[model samples]
Target: MKQKLIVEGHNDILVISHLLMAKNLRITGYNTKERYEKEFVSIGTGKSNNDGGKENALKAFKAALKTEELDRIGLVVDADSETANPAIDTWRSIRNILQQNGYQNLPAEPNPSGTIIAETDKALIGVWIMPNNDSEGYLEHFFEGLINPNDEFLEEARRITEGFVSDERNRFSPTHQQKAKIRTWLAWQDDPESPMGLALRDYPRLGYMSLDTPLVESFYDWLQLCFDTYVE
Candidate 1:
């Protein structure tokens, strides 16, 4: 009778919530941290990847297997390619659980369109490994792709952030360049220091940020397909 989505951290929560609002779509899932009384426990204590969010997600996934009243459950995780294959590792674990729960014919890998696991008398499971089904990146990469091609500010931000290596003050990992670039771009926006969630929600309202990009459209389509029947 309920639909839920489990995301990595507060950033995911903020971005997803505002993106939905910007598009005039109703909130598609419960806010586990805020709606504690509704009794939909989040996959993590708080959606903070720095605080074992990945491991917590597995616990939440395991619990959902027993919550038969749930119409659908979705997990949106970053495919952090720092050292291990976060996306594949996460999927393998969930796939194991689904197999144990009598869900048959599961794919050996995550489907590019979004992975769906379902069976009679059980809640459907939707798994989205961002930045996409194949990429080994974070949610930031997803946002980066949504930046309009004509956005000169982003190009400038990229040039500066990517060139910061010569400053001898850059300490972030190379893999996190996209994160740095996006944040820098956001900081340079008309509203300085605006967050990804706020920028995403507000920019579109102010006639910026493209909602028609293939990446944007694909993400929206994935969400719709994931919970087509569960959410109106």
Candidate 2:
């Protein structure tokens, strides 16, 4: 049987899609068909008014259930830029949407099949990958103690992100740049005591680790957990 996976994410998928392309990974309708015979579906919805973060995530999640054949889901969300802790409201909205649609009892913890990737105060998933400085190039003041301004990882990340975005200027905005940063971060957040927790507590405005890093290994772990918990 083919393995199935569902990722409820935001625009960060755009970068991930690009990263997969760089690795020669063929993503067919969200799933990396050539490698795992598995299906990867992303739900991009959220608040429609403000960049549609919430609306896009809901749309993706809803669409996945209806359009794809998946056994487990990984829901990724931001902590509202570490402003006021919007996780509860964001989660409630998501749950209401799901329950209203027909899900029975949603699990509390991030079940393997259904997980919630959240950061403290970062822009959704900015701190997870590269520091906020790399994206905004101006948030350097906020990154003190959290990350070294001249870290080598930032340069590596920049090289990897070349050609991912068309307009270089967009990489500085709180919305677009932050989203891309988070995508890169998610690709690399599994190391022991990953900076995710510390970043959150220290720099709330910069946001915490949502998934902007290249957390492929972490994602794999999450995928397996979801598969085990929900599939079989």
Candidate 3:
């Protein structure tokens, strides 16, 4: 069985792609708009926000159903809100879109493993929220979890970032604090130009953050279960 993964943006693709590589998974290549063989796992972005990206994801999911090679399809999208206490709103919005496209009986809530998956009539459909399965944040929040517990930089960055956000001159949306925090940490990297995904992949050498966390492992496992099959 060949697998397909649908993500929100380029950064999401970068993160998952690198995570797969870190686990020594031999991915053939990534395709943007074109459809490829099932032997290769192709990842496509749904744009930046939930609306457009989710729409794009539904399209990809439909396309996969038509192909005999695709046996599993996974979705990786951010919760992208201010609070996750009731992650229902965003979850419902995404769920409804998929329901229209053929996915059946998705969970009403996010899974603790950070994934909501179902064995649908079409294929195995999996949904994973960024940073965690039960969070109201984005990739930055996940990056925060991956930061080294001993890194004093994390504390210092938070301190300054909090102060900056409090300033009346600062106009970043309250929900975007995670982005501020992540960029703050990224600035200290040797190659600040490096994308967040690459920075994560090089965490060991960077010495500022460590990806050796339970959350990262959980996410890795989810990816493997969704796509790393050798079925014919």
Provide the overall lDDT of each model, using Cα atoms, as 2-decimal numbers: 0.73, 0.39, 0.66
Residue-level lDDT tens digits of model 2 in 1-232: 2223323332344433433443344433344434432345344435544343435655666665554344444445443344343344455555665555456555432332224333232111111211221121212212222334354554455555554454464455444453355345534544423233333433333443223333344443443443332211
Clash pairs for candidate 3? 46-53, 114-133
Residue 178's lDDT within candidate 1 is 84
The candidate 3 region of ten consecutive residues with least summed lDDT is 30-39
lDDT of 1 by residue, 1-232 (tens): 4877777666876777666666666544543336522443354554445554666776777677676667888788877575466667667877898888778878888877778877777787888888877778877888887777678888998888788765755688777788888998888788987999888877865655877777777777777666642333
Please report, as a residue range, the 10-residue window in candidate 2 with the lowest summed lDDT: 122-131
Evaluated at residue 113, the lDDT of candidate 1 is: 72
Give one clash count per candidate, in the order shown: 1, 47, 2
> What's the CA error at residue 98 for candidate 3, in Å?
4.1
Number of the top lDDT candidate: 1
Provide the lDDT at 123 for model 3: 65
Candidate 3 vs. truth: CA RMSD?
Answer: 4.4
lDDT of 3 by residue, 92-197 (tens): 7667766766667787877767554555356666667776877577778887887887688778778777887788445687667768877877887777777788
Error of 1 at 46 (Å): 7.3
With a 3 Å backbone cut-off (N, CA, C), the pairs that clash in candidate 1 are: 9-47
Q: Candidate 3 at 5: error in angstroms?
A: 1.2
Q: Which stretches of candidate 3 lie over 4 Å from their true place?
A: 27-69, 80-86, 101-105, 116-121, 229-232
